[model samples]
Target: MDSIFHEKQEGSLCAQHCLNNLLQGEYFTPVDLSSIAQQLDEEERIRMAEGGVGSEEYRTFLQQPSGNMDDSGFFSIQVISNALRVWGLELILFNKTKLSDGSGGFLH
Candidate 1:
């Protein structure tokens, strides 16, 4: 059941809804989610082309990714966002690095 839910998440159907609802602006997009859900996705292409964030050994550990970026064997956005939406709250802290002007004014 968890796996199925995760699979749906990886497909990003939930993210689409979120975008339509809670997504304000800037970060997150349905296009971004869909790309990873399908094989030959742009993210995988970019990763391979750019020698992405992980080590070769880690890639090797994942059974070589089957050269298929679209397969959601474990993790995905649907699973992640669903979990987040169901039991999540946004947390942002006040920026402590405000600048102090010479006139005792602080800038955030």
Candidate 2:
């Protein structure tokens, strides 16, 4: 499928934009950012906060694999994976790492 591009807001709306792009079509209604943000729990919101990663709460959130739909500022791999799974799709992540040596090999 061709993706529709959307520039995200300053903060806390990347996932909403992603969802809008993913669901923009006749059969799917767009999701609202505020609605999604409202669904987040206190802990998730804290995790989403700027510089929250240094906090113990964010550390705890990272340790757990549950509650994928909590609007934690940015969407993690697990969140996207769970969202795709709900739509009967699988999420595949790809990365390329460049070699530090003089050789031009890339690791995938």
lDDT of 1: 0.43
**Residue pairs with backbone atoms closer than 3 Å in model 2 (clashes):** none
Candidate lDDT (C-alpha), each? 0.43, 0.52
lDDT tens digits, residues 1-108, model 2? Answer: 486655445466466566546756322222433333234445465655555667887677667654534435555555555455556877655446545763455332
Each candidate's TM vs. the true structure?
0.25, 0.39
Candidate 1, poorest ten consecutive residues by summed lDDT: 1-10
Query: So what's the TM-score on candidate 2?
Result: 0.39
Report the alpha-carbon TM-score of model 1 versus the true structure.
0.25
